[model samples]
Target: MPSQVEVMVKALSRLLGWIYTFCWSASFYPQPIYNLRRRSTKGLAIDFAAINVLGFICYMLYAASFLYSPLIRKQYAARNPISPDPTVRFNDLAFAVHAVILSIIVYSQFWPQIWGFRVSRYQHVSWPVAGLFWGCLLAILILTVVVVTQSPDGGSDPAYWAWIDVLYGLSYEKVLITIVKYCPQAWVNYKRKSTVGWSISQILLDLAGGVLSLAQLIIDASFQDDWSGVTGNPLKFLLGNVTILFDLVFVVQHYILYKSSGDGEDDNKAPDPRTPLLPEEQALQR
Candidate 1:
């Protein structure tokens, strides 16, 4: 039986979780909306979009496996022994699925013919970045095969189950992606000296989401009197903080760094991607 205070605190944590989920999920919208309205993906980094989709797909798999997969959950319990199942919650799962969908939409806008949007000549996923993501995805597939093939007989040795480690590997990969994904966008902004076409709405909402997520984790751990919920899930914590750090960088880049007339564009605007190229440039495009 739980105390009334305990019940109330748990409810509060649930509320916070939902709130952060909304914020984080909503953060995915503005960029695609901005692109749709402008009919262009100018100034947007396709590399960022490309890998963002990949990261969220990994996150979705990790969240879903820990939340729903009996085998993975059993293995997790075997390792933790005392700890409750992995801290992945319904909100986390919801956010990951929602992110995957929205990120794919945003990434599609990078293609001119696919989404009926114009893209800047410079807008492309660099071969190195593309290859890196391909390698990461290939690694994921190979590990899945290994886990499937190496699966042993019933109750032989829980330690031998590779799926648990594979799930954790997915989470760790997400953490790595979160750390690196923003670099391309930030570099693009810096090189252009502008934040145009990179929606600041997403940045502000992402910041809110990241802060609220960390707060919810802290509150949940304090109320439960189990710091393992926090310490055991360092990658989750890192995801929230790293997202906040980069969102702040984008906020600064949009507001203080490139803010001239406060429209999230530079004073001397970069040439529009939708502008008709000169005849020679069009010929080259053909």
Candidate 2:
């Protein structure tokens, strides 16, 4: 029932939503990769690395469900709301293959512990518990895909795919935990009156991403109950809105940190270049 232009706009909207949802790598890859290259782990939390390597599994599975799941269109006026056209079956298969490959990248982050591992032992995970869950999901996912694809019914249920997404979201809980721990360590380092081990750049980018994504989610959620694709998804509305608010805390904290660092720099006394006056200084002056 939706017009051509409307459909295209809505489709584009949804595409952007999906893109932002998987923007985890965009958030993580830059700093971590840079740190690894420079070997300057300063201001980089080891826990973030460990949890991140482990968290990739969750993110990848999430990416899998997202990339593979059928999208129900929100229409202008329709009893059954969806585009009548058949989604490409083969494309799903191919994308699913790529998902499997990405999963390997996720799983490979957790292998035999050797110094060659980019993550330090202090920062690397001792137990890849999150990694294991993602690995299992990946295994089950392949089997599920093969069977479902071969079956009479093409894999088309959003509900079925939602489980993987659920797991994926759940996996981020540990990432939050790791970040929480790292934040305190960050605070402690600065408590001595210097932003000694903090990277304001990282926090700034995080704030920027969080804010924009928050707007995106608000747009998505405002339409959830509408069932009209034009409005967007309501669940996205709730989660995205909440995230925007909570992320503000970090923004404030980082701003305060920036100011404090300036104060610390100013408070540091210059080296005393003046030579000490000897006991005979009074006689010399006379």
Candidate 3:
């Protein structure tokens, strides 16, 4: 158990964590939106999209299983006090829907690149089906998910199956994918000693959010007497805040190198793929 002053500091830590996280969420759009409008993914890393797909799939599982989760039911009842019935918990189905939608769109993000091992990419699939399928799925998924997660017990640990689903399903293949697909690209970029262009703001925010999350962990440790990640929910307890520090540091390293070295763009830039590859760029598939 932490002392009085420690508790206060922990509150501040949570506040900071949430602030940065929300900022990160807000930041998600601008870069992608900009990329779409500009029709260029110049500075964007494919790993980001891949990880997001994994996260959404995890969210889907996280949201769908809440109704059956006894731990969640208990927590929700405790928080609400008024609505203790199981029927009140029926609204917990939205998360699964969102997860599916997010997964679909996440695939769409890379669809152009991967859509065609066959024909030209633009001719691969009907745009309408792809778009509408994801849009509807996301809408239904989000509504139900929000109803549950925000209902006082939203952040409760996942059910056992949900835990397993997320752990195995959302294994970020970004780093591995990067190694396989982009390693050669990275080597070429390194030879030129620059990123053909990776989005600066996105990576920067990813780093910041990771740091803020770590700070939140430290604060939680400072205030909580038990300080055990070992609750009924072992995954959240054991590995919930995992990899955040490394993520932050990794992003910082990239940002600093890019900042100091100046843009890798040349005076006569003629759309050479090798032009923007960074000397240090490699293995971000995770």
**Winner by TM-score:** 1
- Our tally of clashes for model 3 stands at 24
Residues 1-286 of candidate 2 have per-residue lDDT tens digits of 8789667655655665445434422444444344434434444444444444433444344334434444422111122245222221232233334434443443344343421334334544334444544555575566556546654445334434423334334334433433443454355344534443344444444445445445544443343433332222222233334444534544555567455443211222343467454346657987
Give the 10-residue window scoring lowest on summed lDDT in candidate 1: 260-269
List residue ranges in candidate 2 displaced over 4 A. Answer: 4-26, 33-38, 69-193, 227-247, 258-286
Which residue runs of candidate 3 sit more than 4 Å off their true CA positions? Answer: 1-10, 42-48, 59-68, 72-107, 112-192, 230-286
- TM-score for candidate 3: 0.47
TM-score of model 1 vs. true structure: 0.86
Which of candidates 2 and 3 is the stronger one according to lDDT?
3
Q: List the residue pairs that clash in candidate 2.
A: 74-229, 75-229, 220-233, 221-233, 221-237, 223-231, 224-234
lDDT of 1: 0.82
For candidate 2, what is the TM-score?
0.48
Best by lDDT: 1
Reference-based TM-score of each model: 0.86, 0.48, 0.47
User: TM-score: which is higher, 2 or 3?
Assistant: 2
- Local distance difference test values of all predictions, in order: 0.82, 0.41, 0.42
